[model samples]
Target: MQTQLNKHDMSSIKATIPHYTDVFNLTNTSRPSETDFRADIKETMVKYVTFLRKNDAPFFLSMFPIHYVNNNSLDFDFAFMDNRSSHKVNDGNATYTNAFEFLYDSCHWALAKANATSVKIVIGAIGWPTDSYPGANVANAERFYKTFLPFIASGKGTPMRPNQTINVFLNNLSDENRLFLDLGSFQRHWGIYKFNGEPKYRIDFSGKGRDLYPSTAKGVIFMPNRWCVFNGNLDDPGKVEYMKSLACSESDCSSLDLGGSCENLTYVEKVSYAFNRYFQTKGQASQTSDDKCHMGGLGKVVPNDPSNGKCEFPVEILSAENVIEGATFGASGSSRDRVHGRMSLSAGLLALTVLWMIL
Candidate 1:
């Protein structure tokens, strides 16, 4: 790939090989020097490092401190870069106060063992999610980035590599509703922005300790404010359950799971959430007597918002197909065409731009 890119005058775009943090040790990640890479992984890394050096490429490493808290029962405070954490790891003269540095140096030690100490390392993906778990909330996400961004900008590097430049790319941009849930529901909620182009919380990308909301997408077209909600009727309990199951199976219902944002909602609210999700996903158009919102006479469309505290029943956005069709056929060469042309430009700008910060 490097050779082909070089031939095409694209040699400036370096090849980056991404790997998980677990490639360092099989048993534990906290102790760096006390562990060695698995035989198969070590062989692969040796070959990869050789190729990377030949092509002047960089090694991209993905680290997630949230996974340690969720999967390994690590201290919650230790995941953040704040120094007030009670949990600390003593490795020789270096005391590790945060999981980020612990994992970075762990990978550094593995690279040294592989004789790839000269190769550059880039953080390909690292960020906290805002939902789908108890620890995964807006406050925690804000707290994590508040300290982590400054630490990255500080250029303190790790115990193994001091004062070295670190390039990092945030894990994602927007929440993904249709993501696979095998790794955990949190995987779909790892976005700083909501799926509808709204900022989830305040974040200072400059790493200067500023508290302000990020820029939001402008000119986003949304569907009608009407929401499909469950009527106060419990005559047919079995049918309600079946309807909710069908709706959730066809749409996203991960937010209703334990520790999710909507976990505290009432049973009726949960059913309504599922039903509304399905209705919005199916497009809010009414066809004859049968509508998507008609859930066995238990569902109805309402103009009022059904959001309860933090649990939001979101309105779907206008489909891209409609936008393009209107732009292409509404006016051949008039103000309508110009207006839709700008809308198309805005839509193109809405394309995902991954945040990459170098420190």
Candidate 2:
């Protein structure tokens, strides 16, 4: 890749590899000389840094203070950028008030040990999730970025490299409902905006400490404001449980887990949430013959909103078919033909689902 870039006269494009905070054994925070890269990572970094130095490239690293606090059972306040709690870390003359700076400088120490102190560092991904775990909420995410962004904008580098410019990129722009859950359910909730392109909370992206929300996407089409809820029929508890499991198996139910937004919901409410989530994702087809809300006749579509406090029962947006149809309306014949082909494929899938239900 580097050779190709150089051949194309694009040597200015730097190559970077992402790494977590555990790249080094930061046992002695007070002494940079004592810090060393992990044994297995040492050889790799030594060889990689040679190329980086030759090309004057930057080292890319990912840092998540929230993960540190959650996995290590550390104080929650320690994760905040402006934290001044009793959990402050002292590294010689430098007093680290937050985990972000501690981890940032730790990477610098590791780079220095690799004999690549000249290589600049760029933060590849850093942001907080808004659900699926304790301390992962809109308020906490907002608080984190509020201080961290300004700190980044201020150009106040870590204790190891003071007053240096650092480049960073936020992890994501919008929530991903279908994201893989290997890392944790929180991975899907890291977006600053909801899946519908609405800002989750106030954020001053300019990093000037202004209380404001980002601009929302305009002209978003949505389904009707109806929710599929579990009827108050508990005669067959086993059937109800089976229906709930089936709904969750085909849709998102992360919010029903411990520490999640809907964790405190009653059993009936939990079942309703699962059913409604599946219904919404199916384009809210309660009125159609292929109704998703019909959980063995235990579900009902209600006009009244089922949302309670932070536990929101969201309405889904218009399906992709509508968007494609609109886009191909006045397009060239070839473009319309291609879109129609895709729509036919979607229709075939729907037909298969309906046939399977009949079977």
Candidate 3:
């Protein structure tokens, strides 16, 4: 039960849910508690509750605040915490302890307000990153989940709230590089699977056995096998540094930043990493400009995978045209023939359409 007010009407939202007792207003704001922000939120809450009341919806509405709780009363349902402990905590015990502690505190406060244990709890988000920055690697993520899944399944709640059933949703399903740019680059890396719907590692959601493979998305198309690399024979070696910086700025260089998997790369390798990322991300379209491939004469297109050691130079995948058409995952393929096949099919379709128009 979470959605944008602008995106979905109340009726549309209700239609999707059979019966829900909780609704969350998790709208993100920079200065979350500013006067105007509070006023707008209060108005929305009033209207939302009023609508629910008219329909006899019998629901508890939760309003998420930035730092501190606002207007604490039984009228409000509960608070929200976008708990991303894996951003810093690498130790499994610490992460589990912190997550439950956060939930316990929220539960305690909500119960105190209602003066009873009738008030319930919900964990808005809990997840780990699969790449970018220190502690964001797949191994650490797998470690965290291995410890976390079992703890929740045990039904042993935190010290403050024992044996309480709290609803928990993992932070994300797959990597979306487009969202949360204001947060660090790691924001997009917080997926159980990589961007193209491939699993990073084995995970057991059931707590039965660590045998679950990631579900891959269907109909995923990939760019060609070609990669852009730094020119080895550049007249001006100084230009190489400039091109490296420029390429990183225009594309994702989080993999080359501090604590990244590629943090130990040589000067030339760093530039190549950035150049290849940009090339792969742009779909490797047939009509792509030569200038895009040329980093001031310091870039070159190569037909080889540049992934070295633990440093992976990723090739982007083309998602289905619409977001809603997307789903959760399982295959990977990239060849010149496959890419050419795609291009040929597209061109043939276009030609057919043109002939039909002429006729």
Instruction: Give the least accurate 10-residue stretch of model 2, judged by summed lDDT.
Output: 335-344
lDDT of 3 by residue, 1-359 (tens): 33353256653443112211122122232111111213434455445444543443333322122112222221111122224333221222333224334334433433333333343445555667655654567876676667666767777776556685555667556555556555456666666755444456777777544756645433445544577888776577778778777776666777676667788998778888888776655544324454576767777788887778888777555434422355332224532223211112323333344334323
Best by TM-score: 1
Q: Determine which window of 10 residues in candidate 3 has minimal summed lDDT.
A: 29-38
By TM-score: ranked, best first: 1, 2, 3
Instruction: Pick the winner on lDDT between candidates 2 and 3.
Output: 2
Q: Candidates' lDDT values, in order? A: 0.75, 0.75, 0.51
lDDT of 2 by residue, 46-127 (tens): 8887788889988888877888777767788889976654677667788777878877777777778788889888899899
Model 2 root mean square deviation, Cα atoms? 9.2
Backbone clash pairs for candidate 2 read none
Candidates 1 and 2, the one with greater TM-score = 1
For each candidate in turn, the TM-score is 0.85, 0.84, 0.60
| Each model's backbone clash number | 0, 0, 4
